[model samples]
Target: MEIIFLDQNKWIELAQVHSGRIKGGPIAQLFPRLVAAVREGRVLFPLSVANIMETAKRNDDVSRRLIAETQAMLSLGYVHRSRAARIEVELRAAIQRRFGIEPERMPTHWAIAPGFMQAFEPMDELMASPGELARVRRMTSLVDPAALYLNYMVTQDDTRRREANAKLSEGLSALVAQIEGRRARFASESLDMRRRIYAAQSWVDHLDVLNRIVAALGYSFDDLSALGDSTMRALLEDVPTMNVEVEMATRLEAKTGTLSANDVLDMQSFYTAIPYSDRVIAEKAAISHAQQAKLDSKYGVILSRSLEDLSGHYVS
Candidate 1:
């Protein structure tokens, strides 16, 4: 099946079509075909953590429910792992590739579970009696539409939403402040200099992923510290998602537009979707950013803003 990552806005548009609020549009035209493709097992729309978080933080319950229902039906609750988890997976493979060793393969199946897997919180496992566990397992179904809806609906709870959104607001404020601060600091640097600096800084920024990768490799920090600058750059280039993230950041950071949380979320979405998904249908800005980095060509992904363009594929 073709893996397509739809941008949150596109998903909303499709949601409108599904809700019959939109009578005519590219998304409306494409809706039934897309659904048939999904039902036929010819195409799969995988949800990103961005999709879940963005939808959750919306203030409109009707709109949220509309989107939640639409996504639950189409996505069947498939979602990419959290950002750290995704990078850790890619970093591990990048290490193996550097050493010319065949790494453990990626998960062959799209992630499927209840919609809670799409949430930002970590799931706590519970101990259950063997017979009870068996009974619950038999009853558990990832494909249950209501379960997925309820998963997203949890975020709509007033107290929880306020708590979650407060943190998100703080993050957004800090991100914007950080960018403006960096822009002022780099005011006199040449474009080339800034790009180079950002590329190097990108590696340092993902220290968490690097830490996990080192531990998994059974190596101490000092053991790999001597790999040298050039060697590190080469390994990062081989790491598809990191390469995409850094390249996109360099271009974006060079620009003068006021940065927002949406931009960071787009980067998060692209970092995962551009490298892994066969087709990435995202917003115009994100698509342009990835294209500017030549990510689509390098990664062999069909990156487009037009859902109507999807007409040619997955017709079963």
Candidate 2:
């Protein structure tokens, strides 16, 4: 199946089409065929953490509900796993292969779990008898993605979502904040040099995660540390998400881009989607940054801003 990732804006447009708010535009023309593709399993549009969290910030209940329902239909409960989760898998695979050890296989469910999990770790199912548990599972195997989305997207009475969003936003800010603060120090550095410098720093920042996986493999972080600089550079490139993260981060810093929370979310979206999706429709600024970074060619994803780019999808 062709995996497609839509930015939250594109999703809103598609949602407008789905709601008949848009009747004769490029998105409207593309809608029916896209639905057919979904039913036939010829294509899929996966949700990302950015998409979910951004939608929750919307206060328009009607628009939020429409987008939620539209994404539910297209995504069918498939979201890219959390960035924390995905990089671990990537780190494990690369480390195991570097050591000539056969890699451990994780279930595909690890990559694709119920969307209600909201792109976090899989929640454990409640305890129950085997027969009854299986029966309930089968029934809710058709989980309500619409309801799942509405639960978070359409809340006015609760401080829980506001607190959750604040915490999640804060978690993403540290790396960007650290990198951005050092901008003046590196302003004179060449782009490639800066990218490499930041890449190494990014890896070091994430060493705690790598160390956990290293311990599990009966190895220590020093074994990974012992690799020559050239080999380490190659290993960094082998991990797609980090490569994009470093490249985009460097590009933004190069252009003296203003930092914002949305910038962090954009990074999250690109690092997850550009590496994994066949096509990515994101904000123009994002597509521009990725294109300038040459990420589109690197990942072989069609990075576009216009829904008309999808017009050719089902055409033969």
Model 1: per-residue Cα lDDT over 70-186, one tens digit each: 787677766664555455567777776655568887556423233445323243012235664454345445346445455656545678887988898798779768877887789
Candidate that scores best on lDDT: 2
Expressed as tens digits, the lDDT of each residue in 173-235 for candidate 2 is 775686577787898999989898889898898878878988999988778768766766777
Candidate 1 has a TM-score of 0.85
Q: Would you list the clashing residue pairs of candidate 1?
A: none
Q: Model 2, stretches more than 4 Å misplaced? A: 105-110, 121-142, 145-147, 150-157, 166-179
Query: Every model's Cα RMSD, please?
Result: 4.1, 4.2
Off by over 4 Å in 1: 109-146, 149-151, 154-156, 190-192, 208-212, 220-228
As a whole number from 0 to 100, the lDDT of residue 181 in candidate 1 is 85
Q: Judge candidate 1 at residue 126 and give its lDDT.
A: 23
TM-score of 2: 0.85
